[model samples]
Target: MCRHVVPASASRKALLLQALLLISAGMVGTWCVQAITIETVNKASEVMCVRYWIPNEVGGGCNEVRMGNKWDIQVTDRWKAATVWATEGGCGGAHCNTGPPTGVTQFEITVDGGWSNDYYDISALAGFNLGLTVAPTNPTCASQICTSLSTCQGVVPGGPDRTKACKYGSASYVLTFIK
Candidate 1:
């Protein structure tokens, strides 16, 4: 009986291992670059709420306020301090359905100038007003809208003294992704 055998080459083994190492190193290097290049829109976010128009009630009120689509003030073209109304049920998935008979849908956008730049703080929202910190954060592209409508904080009303608890002085948006 006769048997045939194939010879193993040492150079071939070394070359195969070198190729694998190069590929692994390249993958690691790509991930590192992507990690450092990723960023978000300066803590900006939106909430969803349904509007309710009741029947025959005074002071912007109605008799039977039924639930409407979720909505709130939305920011668009954050540059030049721009924003507008974003339709309800379109806030993506961050909106919470808080049952029926809802009167207001609150969408809040918080800018992170520093730790102190908050939205809920009444005093801060009323004072030291600053423009937005992002661009094209969002846009519906319909009517030319005013930036005032999209802000949780508005200009201080002129009068003797009237304080509302709707200050947006301490809100910020942050998201995390796993890859």
Candidate 2:
């Protein structure tokens, strides 16, 4: 009679490979859930208002985020899309300035699925009031920074070109105002 024994390391590697295969084949009974965080860092000279909304859903109204302050949005599971804006003044009442000249910084994100590719971008089409940067926690992903109207996209006379897509198990984004 002949018998064979497998090394512990080899056995562990085989188990890992089987798990990955199961996950990819959707045979595992668990769904992939990704945690996403969007943090805003205000580095401007004055107080700035930040607003975010998902399409077809009621959104958070403009709120003041003072210099050196931060605002955060946390989401779990899958989200279709969200748009965030950084503006100069408050909404309604006496402030109510949500347009250009002072400019408005726009950031958009879309997470299709935990196993699917996610997308993000910074647009100055609305205007370029403040310098903007989008930094992803995943170093394998790319970062986008637009410090001027000329260097940004979505503006008139130019086509959209600042979008990026990546697959991250857990995603974290930091939006910084560089002005």
Candidate 3:
């Protein structure tokens, strides 16, 4: 009878240890989740390279999986805007360099995605951004795409600010990036 009692006592002790271990794990997981929220904030900034697929012509919108070149640009009017912004994930996600920074002509916020997402307009969007501009997705001259692309295709993933230019066209695709 004494041996039986000793075994049962040990089992209860083991069970208590296991319970404590599980509770500690749950607490650590909770802390980690909270940390992520804060981390993402620190990670996000205004100036970043925005990846885009600009059509070669205005009449035609570009949508190939090609990576576009990125530039350094600003996104602030003052105050919150004054802080430098930085980001990666550009050029079809290949040229993701947030090291120095990047630039663009202008920016806009489009609600087409039902999320009021910000997008930058490209000069090429004029043809597509207009009330009506229709054409196939290819340029007349495949080699000389951007040159002869006058009104051929108007695309926007960036702008020079409202004062510099107002490119008001509903963008079909634009990826807003932040560091």
Candidate 4:
């Protein structure tokens, strides 16, 4: 019988090369970076709403509206701040939608981590009078701001505010993750 043995170093190199090839081919999906989840909380008395342009899974854009209270927004671009338009309004009693853009709040940009984690800057931007605290540590955030949209604080309004809630505020937070 013929004897055959692969050197330890050679075996390691081959494995490393294989791993690199897989990664380059986009086959490896463990530690890839993709999007950031922007979570928000509206502390003001007026209900908050948001309108953003997120690339949908299909191809086009996901033009969505996230009502105030608490929302989790999934975004891809880490540099460009999400174009969010907010307003103050709600359903009086019956099904009501559409809230005028009276309280439009711009957002600041903050980035953390590299190819794994994601952080954002929400200190300030423009046209936003409401206090927006990015990555808040106050306990009020958890209690006041719905941890997830499922149990979010406010209800979806009828008219223009009919979209889902993904707006950030003084109590807004950035929930980082790796894709």
Best by TM-score: 2
The residue-by-residue lDDT of candidate 4 on 1-179, one tens digit each, is 12345566787779889779988998874432334555655554355444443222222121223333465665443433334333444323422223223334433333233442223332222333444434433344332222233432321221323222222322334421110
Query: Number of the top candidate by lDDT?
Result: 2
**Candidate 1 Cα outliers beyond 4 Å, as residue runs:** 1-67, 72-82, 85-110, 114-116, 119-179
Q: Flag the better candidate by lDDT, 2 or 3.
A: 2
lDDT tens string, model 1, 1-179?
12333346547778668668978778432211111010122111232222212122221111111133112222211212111112222234432322122222222222322342312111122322222222221232111111332452322232213221211222222211111
lDDT tens readout by residue for model 3, 3-119: 213345568779778668978778422211110000011122322233222122122111112123233232211111111122333234343222212342222222111232222
lDDT of 4: 0.37
Residue 155, candidate 2: alpha-carbon lDDT: 33
lDDT of candidate 3 at residue 16, scale 0 to 100 = 74
The local distance difference test score of each candidate is 0.24, 0.68, 0.25, 0.37
Give the Cα-based TM-score of candidate 4 against the true structure: 0.40
lDDT at 168 for candidate 1? 22
CA lDDT, candidate 4, residue 118: 28
Per-model TM-score versus the true fold:
0.17, 0.67, 0.17, 0.40
Off by over 4 Å in 4: 1-10, 16-36, 53-68, 75-79, 83-85, 90-103, 110-125, 136-179
Candidate 2 per-residue C-alpha lDDT over 29-143 given as tens digits, one digit per residue, 9 for 90 to 100? 5555566778888887578777776664443444678888988877544456666767664443533232222257677777753456677788766666878888888888878
Off by over 4 Å in 2: 1-33, 90-103, 113-115, 153-161
Better of 2 and 4 by lDDT: 2
